[model samples]
Target: MSALVPALEVFLVFLRLGLTSFGGPVAHLGYYRAELVVRRGWFTEAGYAELVAVAQFLPGPASSQVGMASGLLRAGWPGLLAAWVGFTLPSAAVMFALALGMARWGEVEGAGWLAGLKVAAVAVVAQAVAGLWGQLVTDRRRAVLALGVAAALLVLPGAGAQVGALLVCALAGWHLLPAPQSTERGLPAVPVSRRVGATLLLVCGAGLVLLPLLAPLSEVWALLNATFRAGALVFGGGHVVLPLLEAGFVPALVSHEHFVAGYGAANAVPGPLFTFATFLGAAQTQMPPLWGAVIATLGVFLPGALLMAGTLPFWAVLAARPGARSALAGLNAGVVGLLLAALYTPVFTGGVRGPRDLAVAVLAYAALTAGRLPAWAVVLACAAVGWAVL
Candidate 1:
């Protein structure tokens, strides 16, 4: 009963965030910081920063991971599950509904509202890149590293390049960047045991390795494998997962038009951008829409949950080390570069059709950064603009 109360509280709080948090992963972090750190006093500022660092260091949705970690700290394992479900359900439901509509109506090629959503996505990704660049690329060396990563990916675009750039940046940061000074503040005691943490990690690894082998057995396994790999391997979540997902589904399972449109719709909805997987799963023709949604959503989210639970017990010691901090710094910059590349190729290319679309995107960007309009509003305004003008 005592445990259930905190878990339920966590659920309601996250459910609200799920409904209201917008502007992509970075904005979601701000919401989390305000709600969990400032309002609830669930964690000290330093402790919260450490939690963010751990989430960013892992290979999944950073905002979702942070939320999961917050829940774990607040109310144990049950809290972790509660936080994820509450935070994910709203957007997942929205995306699933969008998918159902797309399935029934067929491809919505050149639809003005869809075009507006795509254009809005451009502004959203641009905002994310600008925000992240300011936060991550602090020094000259880091800036150079970010540029190099962007250039590399733009020149040779693929999941391989994305993953490789991150790895190289981590190595560069470890070897070249100055070590960070140790902080006195540490994380609150996590509820997980080291043994439990190790077991979780092992399970996560086993799923990553084994799921691929099982993918040939059925469409369900194949979908799970693709979504799981996307969730398990990507460094920075949100827009960063775009390429991996495009590679996994586009032209094969889900059409290119639907893929781009769904991404745009995802920006319009509140919650983790990862719930875009829900859209993809439901939009695909390989299986029943609801079943695909269920599998894809669970598969994509499972790795992050597992990784966060597995690493919490060891994070304090790992975070205390300077080398880890330096590497993370480099990796973060690389992520910015990756987003920069994505902004150009898929986001910009797919969103902007001509001068009119570009104009709409520029206006939307101004609305977001200067006018301080919320992302959902920007999305709607862009859709309106697309409907009326574009």
Candidate 2:
């Protein structure tokens, strides 16, 4: 009953987040902080922020991590499930429906509402960068790292930017910054039974690499493996996932044009940026719409859930060990650089298209930082403003 009540409450909170939370993962953090921490007193604002940072540093969706962590804090595993469903279901449903509709009706031409949605997405993501920048880009050394990473990625072809940037930052931070003051406060690293850990890793790896090879099942397998890889290996949250995802689908079977279009549409809708999977799924040539939706949804998210479950039990011990601790600290710093580069690529380049778009982004940022309006209101208003002005 105690468990049930908390789970139910979590479900309701996530449902609300699902229904109204606009903006992507970064903005979603603000919404979660405001609602879960400030309004409900579920956790300290610091705690929530830390979780977000850790999630960003790790290799899965930021918003999903937020939900999972929040649930674990609130009611253990069940809470995690509630948060996952609450966070993911709404956007997934919308994207799935849209995919089905698109598959049947074909692409909607001259979609003014969608155009507005894309414009608003730009503002939303830009606002996310601004908001996170305040949290991440403190002091000079880190700032330099951020700029260096952004410039490098911008200049280099197939730079493999995010992970590369992270590695650099981690090395710099390890050598430069002193050990953190708190011994007790650092994330607890738990070690799993090595046997179990090895087995799970092997299973996940086999499924991830091999699924694409077996053909009558190739499309289905490819969708699953690619998304699972995104969920499993590509750390540093949703924006970071953009590069990995783009690489996965583009110029292969899926056209670059479709990739761009689906991402634009994904940004327009509410819920997690991970819902972009639905768009990818819907676009598949071989799968039926229903099958596409199911495959996409599971393919994208399952690996993250499995990885987290497999990892968290052992992560505590591993994180605290001297070598692992040092490495992870560097990783954290690297994540800062990665996020900085991401700010330039997808969030800024995609969002700031012209003066009108720039104006909308600026206004949206101001409204978010100064006015403290709800994120949903910002999303709706920006959509309207984008339509009116653009």
lDDT of 2 by residue, 1-390 (tens): 765898888988998888766656655665776677545777643334456545654567777777776776677668778988888889888877776555433344344444454455455545544544454455676567656766776676232555566667667766765444335233323234556656765677776777657634667667776777776776655655677777666766467877777776677677888888877777777768677767777777766665554555555555555555544544543444444455555556655667777777777767766877655676678667655666
lDDT of each: 0.82, 0.64
**Top candidate by lDDT:** 1
Clashes of 1: 0
Each model's TM-score, in the order given? 0.67, 0.71
* Candidate 1, 1-390: lDDT as tens digits: 876999999999999888766556755675675577545778754466567657766899988999999999999989999999999999999999999875544444556777787787788778767766775678999999989999998899865677788889989989888765554243568898989999999999999889989999999998999899999988756778889888888887899999988987787677899999999999999899999999999999999999999998987666567897777667767877876887887778888989989989899889878887666577778778888877
Q: Which ten residues in a row have the lowest lDDT in candidate 2?
A: 182-191
RMSD of 1: 5.7
Model 1 stretches astray by more than 4 angstroms: 1-79, 94-103, 182-191, 206-296, 312-316
Error of 1 at 241 (Å): 9.8
